[model samples]
Target: MRVLTVNAGSSSLKLRLLGPNDEVERSTDAEPGVDLEEVLRAWPAPEAVGHRVVHGGTRFTEPIVIDTGVRKELEDLTALAPLHQPKSLAGLDAVTAQLPEVPAVACFDTAFHTTIPQAAATYAVPGEWRERYAIRRYGFHGLSHAWCSARVARFTGARRIVTAHLGAGASLAAVLDGRSVDTTMGFTPLEGLVMATRSGSVDPGLVLWLEEHEGLSPREVAETLEKRSGLAALAGKADMREVLAAAGRGDAGAVLALDVYVHRLAAGIASMAAAAGGIEALAFTGGVGEHTPEIRARAAERLAFLGLAVDPARNDTNEGEITAAGAAVRTLVVPAREDLEIARGTRAALR
Candidate 1:
């Protein structure tokens, strides 16, 4: 079935019309202020519409048909993913408004990680708080991770894999036999490896201390952690490419930023490997993961203990299996394909 996938980001909306054979028949990236109706009118109406919803919370674990109840539930989840859920809802509204007759599915980023075991998903918090708030790890970037893991398994025939989805935002998933056993992201997208702007895995005590001693309001703390931290705070630039360039120029801050970034990434990969028992294949996807050979090489070097090493020439090629000869672990670079995953989920939901 032909499916039109809608992926809404903080600043842009990505629309991809996939043909029955999964070819990208047409695609467009609409920034804020673009007329959604006009954009939809320009393309052929799709038989189905699939939306990339950031948070499905504890309720929705798989792709489901978007209906009055589902829409309401999704809206209620806005607080869980305040930065992304509204944008997704807006995109859903726009597409359904343009083609109300087409079957629409809400494909969640959290769905794939729903299989994570309780030992990994549960937080070491008060039972009352945990039960009342449903606070647990609900991994993000799962659609990308799912696609990468599947590709890695097909390419290397590995049952245990670690898939890293690195971009403006980043996370790693430990997949065993096609199911997510553990992941870096937790509760929200801000809990994993250092991202473009988000501070990953900060101490709760530090946040409370700022509020108690520094007298910073909750809003201020949130804003700083979500928008003013990470590589941006470290190097004055959020983009990895720019940071790498600055580092190459002997910029101390950029060099330190890259070091910390890779450190956290490698450590997270090790943790994921532990969760999956061990890593047989390491797959990289997303913008930085696919294009930045330096980051991949650095991460591989750190993970050498796990027998993960990339061939210098293959890594430079920036795609496909880049595993070094005689290495026990295979390494691959897979382009992010959330649209295709969304399409697959849409077809399954409608079927």
Candidate 2:
């Protein structure tokens, strides 16, 4: 079935028209401020519409055909993923408005990681709070991670893999036997490896102390952490390209920012490898993961204990396998394909 996949990120809104076999027939991107409804109205309605929703909370574990009730439920989830959920909701709304008769499916970013074991999902909070608030790690970037793991399996046939989706937002997924055993992102996107702007895994006590002593409002703290922190706060730029350039110029803060980013990313990779006992293959994906050879080489250097080695020549060429032949663990560069995953989920939901 033809599926129109809607992927709205914090920076851009992309729409892809996929053929029956998931071949991209047409694709277009719009700025964050463009009217998504107009974009949908202009394109021919496909057999189904697939939206890349970032969070599904506990209610949505799989792709669901959209309706008023489901839309309401997703609306309620906006509080969970303030940055992504709204854009996803908007995409759904646009589809419903432009193609009222067409079936639309909500493919969640948290769906793949639903396989994460309970031990990893649970948070160390009060029983009442845990139960009442649904306080647990709900890993994000499921679409990217899911696609990466599948591709890794096809390429190297590795049953145990660590898939890192490093982009403006980053996360690491521990996949074993093609299932997510654990992931770095927890509760929300803000809980894992340092992202472009989001401060990942800050001490709760420190934030509370700052609020109590410095008189910072709750909203202010959230804004700062979500938008003003991470590589941006350290290097005065959130885009890794700028940071890398400045670091190349011997800017101390930029150099430190690059160092910290790589450090946290390498640590996250190791942590995920431990989740699955060991990693047979390491896959790098998403924007920075697939394109930045330096980041990949640096991370692999640190993860040498896992027998991961990056062949500099292959890494520079951005080939399939960047790892040296006969390395215990193969390292790969898998391009992110959330659009195809969304289309697949939407087709399944239609069935």
Candidate 3:
């Protein structure tokens, strides 16, 4: 079966055409993005279409066939993941309008962390806020984490693994027996490790203080945190390449930015690894994890105490085997296959 996978972002749409064997025949990004109708109009429609829905909330713990009720629930979830859900449903509507008889599946980023223990997910708050408001953590990047974990199982036959999906939007997950035990992304994508623009893990009191003292509205605060912070706010640019170059040229802020980013990442990974008891293998995926050799090298260096060390030469050249021979913990760079995962998930749902 051929499946067309759509991941709709706030400003762009990522797409791929995948077959039953999980190979991408064609993949592309479109922007100023087009809707699903436009996408389908350009290519042959697949047996099914898989939509990447960012937040399923508590209602959905697995992929589900789209229906009117599901659509409404997804619409309601927009408030929870304002950066993603609107565009996702817009694409979903376009596809449903164009291919009414076709099966469409919603694959959620939150679903993979459904098994996260309450101790890890709960915030220190009243029961009313926790239960009625659904205010516990719901980690994102489920697709990438799932793909990398499965790849680790294939490569090492390891049941305990840590997958770092690093990119402009980054997260780490601890996988035990192929299930998510813990993840860095929490409550929202903004609550994880620092990203291109998103401020990860800031004190909630700071937000309330800003609103009370600075007279900033909730929307303004959200925009600042989600769109104006992180590497961009600290170092003048969010692109890692630029940050590294600036740091090499003696930009203190750039140097500090990189330090904070790596430290937070290492800390999160260490925490997740502890949750799963011990990590048998470590996998890196997504844009930064797969492409930025410097980031990977630095990360591995910090994690050497965990019995992982990278071969500097291999790490510099983007080789999948970054770990040195005889390393206690295997380290690999697994290019994320979210498209394939989406296709497989959607195919299964369609059946």
Candidate 4:
């Protein structure tokens, strides 16, 4: 099946046409206001299209063929993923308008984590709030985590694995027997590891204190935490590469930011290992995970207690199976391939 995968981000739209064997036949990262229909017309027409929807919420647990009803349901989920859902809808509308005859599938980033057990997904909150709001951990980056976990399983034949997706946004997933048992992201993408711009896992009381004592409005607090915090707040830059460079130049803030980032990352990995009972394999994906060897090395050093070690040579190489010989846990790097995962999901749903 030739599948065209559509991934909509905050600032760009990614379109990839995959051949039957899952090779990328054509692809493009179109910025906002690009003529999507014209772009689609320029390529070999895809037999089917798959849209990467960010939040499936509690209802849509799997990929389904997009239709009038499904589109409405997705719109209803906008509140759950305010930053991403609308973009997804816009992408879907544009592509479907271009190829109305072609079948379209909605492959959700939240779908893969739907297998998370109730206990792990639930929050320790009031029953009324939990019931009324449907408040629970709905981990993001499922498409990346799903692909990485399966790739690790294929490489190491390990059923217990932890896959870290570390890019502008980051999260860790604990996959046991090919199912997501637990993950770092919860309820929203803002709940996990310190992102490029997001302050992850802050105390609820601090928000309340800022609102009450500091006289900051709820919107002001949210904007600061979501946009002005994290590495940007610490190092005055959001890109990890710049942060690394500054730290190397003896910048105190960048050094502390890197330390805090690695600390939270290692701690999250350890927690995921606990969730999966033990870690047989550890896989890293996303920009920082694949490109920044220093981040991986620092994380490995901190997680040495879990038998995680990376050969300096292989780590520098930044390729598969960077794990040292005889290590109890196998660690490797997998490039993020959410497009391929969406294609796979689309084929499966159509089948």
Show where candidate 4 strays beyond 4 Å: none
Q: lDDT per residue, candidate 2, 246-298, as tens digits?
A: 99999999999989998999999999999999989999998888889999999
Candidate 3 achieves a global lDDT of 0.86
What order do candidates take by lDDT, descending?
A: 1, 4, 2, 3
* Winner by TM-score between candidate 2 and candidate 1: 1
Better by lDDT, candidate 4 or 3 = 4
Model 2: clashing residue pairs? 137-187, 138-187
Steric overlap count per candidate: 0, 2, 0, 1
**Which lDDT value does model 2 have at 240?**
91
Whole-model lDDT per candidate:
0.93, 0.89, 0.86, 0.93
- Per-residue accuracy of model 1 over 1-351 as CA lDDT, tens digit each: 889999988788899999999998899999888888898888877999999999999899999999999999999999888888999999899778889999999999999999999999999999998998889999999889988899889888999999999999999999999999999999988898999988899999999999999999999999999999999999999999999999999999999999999999999999999999999999999999999999999999999999999999999865799999999999999989999999999999999
Residues 183-225 of candidate 4 have per-residue lDDT tens digits of 9999988897998999999999999999999999988998898
